[model samples]
Target: MAAATASSPLNLLGFNRKPIFHCKLSSPRCRPTFLMPPGRVPSNSIARTGRTFSNPPSYVLTCLVIPPPPKRQKPKAIIQFIGGAFIGAVPEVTYSYLLEMLAMEGYLVICVPYNVTFDHAEITRRVSERFSSCLDSILGSGLPDLGLSALEVSDLPLYSVGHSNGALLQTLTGSYFSERIPKANVIISYNNRPASEAVPYFKQLGLVVSQMLPVAATFPVNSVVEVASGNAWKLLLDTAETVVPNYDLKAFGSFMTRFTDQLPLIINELAEGISEFKPTPPENLESIRELYNVQSTLLVKFDSDTIDETDQLEETLKPRIETFGGKLEKAVLSGNHITPCLQELRWEVGNVYTPADALGQVLKNVSVNDTRRLATTITNWLDLLSH
Candidate 1:
């Protein structure tokens, strides 16, 4: 203390010269400004990993668990994502990036692969139970690879986010799961019309033509094509390469089966649900209302989505929902039907997360930006719901 250097603070009567100089140097102008737009939150704050499990009642479901940012505040809510018809049980076409973005905004995201054959509400109920059983284990395990850690989960709100056929399933499942209203319901590109009304005339004609073919009727063509990944199937694919345009032998097999065999069953079930005089409807609007009140629902319509029946559904739901002091909100986003599903997907295998084509040339015009925009729109809508 005999001699204090100029770099060191001069402490006299609790005063320090070096500390005063440091304060003067650090002024408001020296601070960096975040010039990006308010809603453009970075998604790197989240982490995700795929999961598969066999729940009770003989059901197999795949899910991607997206946990919140590390060492930050825990997610305030949970979102159960259901994929649409033909969407695989993987990151392939489920808008994985958008799910990650939602996780970044402080929500535990559970993305479950959907199949057209399964009973929607029943599968949802089973999956919900499975999640409830393993949630505590997932949180307590502290799996850094999965970006998950133990956190308080009591009384956390739950949300259901679905697209296309998945959206309709969620509507029915929403009622099946609980009597209370959800924190929010986000429906994207909702297809409410039955297969008869939804399919194009030419496509419907194509189905008829495909069904008449002896090759399609013989053998379990759809089943083989669906799981056509082994050496034998590859040999079959090569032999029929000229006949079928796609790898799945879709032109020769599954294409017809999907439209002809699978679609009608789904349509019939929905029709029964809507019919006023049906003795036993699978799930009707009145039955849904009795099960649960969807107080706050958000319907997102893609501007170029010709297959969208969101408006029609909204019109039907508004009067019924409003009767119980509920609300329905709509947002028309830009892009076509598949934009929300495959925006961030790559055409080539094993290169997940890389936007396949760049500079205005590709199989589809959907972009990573579309995914971001949808994510931003959803977050903004959720913010409004909270208020």
Candidate 2:
């Protein structure tokens, strides 16, 4: 048997010594001491001691300890939306239309902003950070006081929606602050891929790593890495769409035509950019993927004309749909992506709907199972907020 070296013990009773160990110790000096005043006790001559004393009551030296108060209950719900790329170029008309629709049906919605002008890496970073901050704001800002008679009160459901790059932000929101937000009733994502498939591909090359192994060791494959790459791809696609001419022309035209009258409002909102926006990426991929288990529905609308390959888009989204146990609520309207945002759709593009009507449908749909109902829920909620 090989004897253990003095410095590195091999075994003790067949048990190898651990490389590191920890222990806890208490110091006598740290103990508190109580001393009575010299004059409080009478002098004693029996043992030639300066003073004699009786034992003090234990209660006299004990201090009362109070526990901290419990945390307050959070709001009933929180609604957040992620804005697409393009500085201040949110689908405002659609958003407003949806908000008003939801407000009418009694729900609160929050529109989140993301930095689309910056590089992809920067945008991803900002999306995560902004989401965290926005959640903090919503938690801090008490629920919006919707003035309604008690008789008309109802348990307003909370939901979130995101379009284009905004979908990434919504993913981050669900991943990072699920606990702080209300149970998401619906998550309507428009024209975007899942974050796991959109983030990582944003950069031209994968992230570099430095290690001390004899042969360079790489970081273990993780969900974050995969999700980041996917997110990157989505961002790249969005960037290309914005600059590439003739890309989704019909949808672009529809968005422009419908909101052309609200250009000033759109421009003003864009002017502020991410100054009023907050949301951040999730701490890890598992957190974001957990959103699939949430009881929320997702609707993905594509303009068949603008999308050269509809099958490709469907394939890309298939996994996400299955993961969430959700069916892809799709609309293949005659108009391009922009058609859903136009007034012709009666703003139903941004709001939820029950019957799943065409662009000309009115805002009369009202069943949760119906597309029109979802639309009404969104429109009514938006109407509750002024401006």
Q: Which lDDT tens digits does candidate 2 get at residues 1-387?
A: 111111111121332222111111143322222332211111121111110112111100111001111121222233545545552233333443433333334333444443343233445455545443433332332223333221121233344555545554454454444343323323333333333344443222222211222233354434434444355345654664554423343333333332232333323333433222222222323444444333333434433434223334334444654665443333332333332233312123436654545422544222112333336434433332212
Pairs in steric clash, model 1: none
Q: Model 1, residue 365: what's the lDDT? A: 39
TM-score of 2: 0.37
Off by over 4 Å in 1: 1-62, 91-93, 118-151, 179-181, 198-227, 231-292, 345-366
Q: Please, what are the lDDT tens digits per residue for candidate 1 over residues 176-219?
A: 65543255788888775534354435345545555555564586
Whole-model lDDT, candidate 1? 0.52
Cand. 1 TM to true fold:
0.58
lDDT of 1 at 180: 30
Return the lDDT, model 2, position 203.
26
Q: C-alpha displacement of 244 in model 1, angstroms?
A: 24
